[model samples]
Target: MTDLKRVDIYDTTLRDGAQSEDVQFSVEDKLRICRKLDALGVDYIEGGWPGANPKDDAFFARARKELNLSHSRLSAFGSTRRAAARVEEDVVVRGLLSAEVGVITIFGKSWDLHVTQALGISLAQNLELIHDTIRYLKKRVDRVFYDAEHFFDGFAANPDYARQTLEAARDAGADALILCDTNGGSLPSQVGAAVAGLRDLNAVLGIHTHNDSELAVANALAAVEAGCAHVQGTLNGLGERCGNANLISVLPNLILKMGRETSVGEERLPKLSALSRFVNELANRPTQKNQPFVGSSAFAHKGGIHVSAVLKDSRTYEHIRPEQVGNKQRVLVSDQSGRSNLLYKFSELGIELDPKDPRIQTLLEEVKSLELHGYQFDGAEGSLELRARRALGQVPTYFERRGFRVIDERRIREDEDDDRFMGAEGTVKILIGGVMEHIVAEGAGPVDALHNALTLVLSRHYPSLGEIELADYKVRILMGSGSMSGGADAIVRVLIEWNDGERRWGTVGVSDHIIAASYDAMVEALEYKLFLDKVRPV
Candidate 1:
């Protein structure tokens, strides 16, 4: 085997990723992500465009004092001086300098269409801009990277002018010449061919791609195979339009698949999944379950035969061990699960049972029946564990529910142009240790009211029940074969996530009435908490 080529990982999530729709990073958000990127061992972290906005300006101002990065060098991104402007006096150039960063990446128009139509400048004038901007920045910063914006389209439009543009940057002491698929319309073949054509250049070559064609990662790999040494992308593929290349996906493919080395060495690779979720949490976005390598479902196995084989040898279905990237193997239990699936899931939940135990078969059949009725246990392992323990006669009854009532009220305000206000209240009666406890509470919705009432009654006996906060609530309506014709009485499935400071678990319930389903899920979540704590029935 040949020695792996070392590639530089340049992250632009703070700048380009923040441009995604509904994504706006505060100065604090940018600073927090910078520290994460540094710990992940990325070669460079591209801070946002200084002076472009108040948030970015504040971030750079604060970063100079606060960010004591150990591995990554911070970079400031901007564009060339405007047409008919002096490089020294240009406001954008000055903004880049005021950032006080070691590296500066500046993009210039490479497409003839943009130069003539967008900027309305002569071809010779465009070349001069690329040369002068790069030269001026190189003299000031430790390194200057020239991003050839729309280079693929530019090359297809006028190859001679495109080469002249790159030559201008190369001759002006630019450290790296990055080819950008700005429009994200180029095929992998086109990107590889373009990079292969530029192999004769003296400066280091780089690849920056977008996902308009859903080929951002593919195009990046293509460029690397064609001799590019630097790869630029966002962390979760977050950016404008379809988004930029996903470094999370690209990094694993480079190291594990292509045998390439990156600054994210073997030791840091295990933290990849946490880093991916950290960004998603800060962005207030749910992690994409199917995202390659670092996603929750990246290594999850569901099929019965697939699970049966993977139990013996994970290589039968898994491409790489999930632990290599900090993800774990998950065996999902559904209607299609076999004996092996149940055994695997039981072991995962720490429920030990012999392979010949008849209760295992009974639990499997019960799971199949429940799944047929719309109770999905794959995402609600806490509920599944409770069911398994109950079947084994290990779980004791904690409390008996006497009854509950929920009342929803709506009022129309006449002076407010018929605005309707809604409120809900719930009353719960439970028998705990032969003592009847009655509780009442009001909440924004029926489920919330019931949860409040139930917890108020239970917390007196089990104080930790009050500490289990509801982290997430998801409701899915099952239609077609299960319910009434018009969907009025369709079966609703409620999945509730609960967290108690350290651990989180999910429980599922299904019923025709939404309130009933929510109650079942809430009760199960509390029961699971008690089960984990080994709380004895009072």
Candidate 2:
């Protein structure tokens, strides 16, 4: 096979990814994400719709002034024109110009359904929208991309008209014509054939696939093989509906499978998982554990046969090295786990456990018993490792919880004095290396008071702990019926931020009770931070 050619990677995470329901990035968030993307070495960065919203407009305006992008050229996105307006006088066109980006991307209807129904325009007029917009933008910028919206479905419906739409953009001087799976239902074979049909066009062709069919990555790869020169997607596949093609999956597959050279920096590929999690945290969205390439469970294995084979040689069951994508291989201990799995887990935790040792069997039985009680070791490495340390008598806790309580009350006073009420009071007891400490606090609610009292007690002993704060808190109620008898079970996830004049990382905790879960996560967060500080002193 010939060497795979290099293709441009256009990241739309900031623009299209934000279109995912309830996903919004503040200006500071956008700046931080864009800087990370720039460092990742994507060929182009689509900021957002400058004319559509004030936040996006302000982002582009500010990004242009403050960001010093190294490898990527920022692209501003918008539609062509209103059905009746001239391209030169179009509001969207003006908005694109105001963004002051070196590249401008405009979308036009390739699907006759969208043109006739969505835009209420004739097919010929839609062609004009494509041509005129491309022509106008070509004069202003060196890179003008025309997104052929719903190209695959349109081509299947009316091949002649769909080809004509792309011809119009090519004739109008579009640098690259992107075939978008706007509704994202195209098959991989269909994508390959469609791009091949447009191979003779003068303009460079690209593929912009969505994940509605869960085949965006496959479709993109098929398009590349069939002659597309660029791939447009979002990091971690963030976009409307399912999402755009995942550059996280695509980049590695491109380099490793197709032998294509990516613009992404060599070092940055290893940071892909970290970057994906960081963005998900900022968006306040739950991370997909099974997400391809970068998910926590992507490289995780548990079956006895699979674990044994993987231990002998990772290539026995693994397709790619975990570290290649900045993900670590996880060996999960469950009912199906075997001796090999337990041995591997012990090695990972730096624990020495000989298979022949009777204690090994005892420890495995203990783990299995714990698993029966809803203790999941697969997702709680730190907690499991701490347990192992205790079993081996190698662990120490600075303090231990002695007691806790919550009080609630209400009071009413005279009209002249006004009414007053004591809503809640909380108390906590702690024994630090056998030294007892007690604290009390009041709050608007029971959970609030409990957390405050706990923090107050811990703060007195560990003064350095004050530097940490809860950056985000989330509560999820599980399997609760409308009736109070059901007794809703809740789980709280908190992100703790610790600044020691350096950087920070987030840890997670889960429990049935909301307050207990929050406190559990809060304790883990501080412990993890302190452990890091000690091992890697600044």
Q: Highest TM-score: give the candidate number.
A: 2
Writing each residue's lDDT as its tens digit, candidate 1 over 1-538 gives 1122989999999999999997776665677688779988999999989979888888899889878899999999999998879999999999999999989999999899999999999999998899999999998889999999999999999988888889999999998889999999999999999999988876689999999999999999999999899999998999999999999889989999998989898667776876786676556566788999987688788888998998899899999987777677778763232576567657767899999999988998998889778777644768999999999998898998888999998866445666477779999999999999999998878988999999998999999898888766767776554343455567777877677876667788998888899899998998999999999999
TM-scores for all candidates: the values are 0.65, 0.68
Model 1 regions more than 4 Å off: 1-4, 334-538
Candidate 1 has a TM-score of 0.65
Q: Any residue pairs clashing in model 1, and if so which?
A: none
**Local error of candidate 2 at 158, Å?**
2.0
Off by over 4 Å in 2: 1-4, 265-267, 334-491, 496-538
- Error at 93, model 2, angstroms: 1.4
Clashes of each: 0, 0
| RMSD each, Å | 8.0, 7.3
Worst 10 residues of 1 by lDDT: 479-488
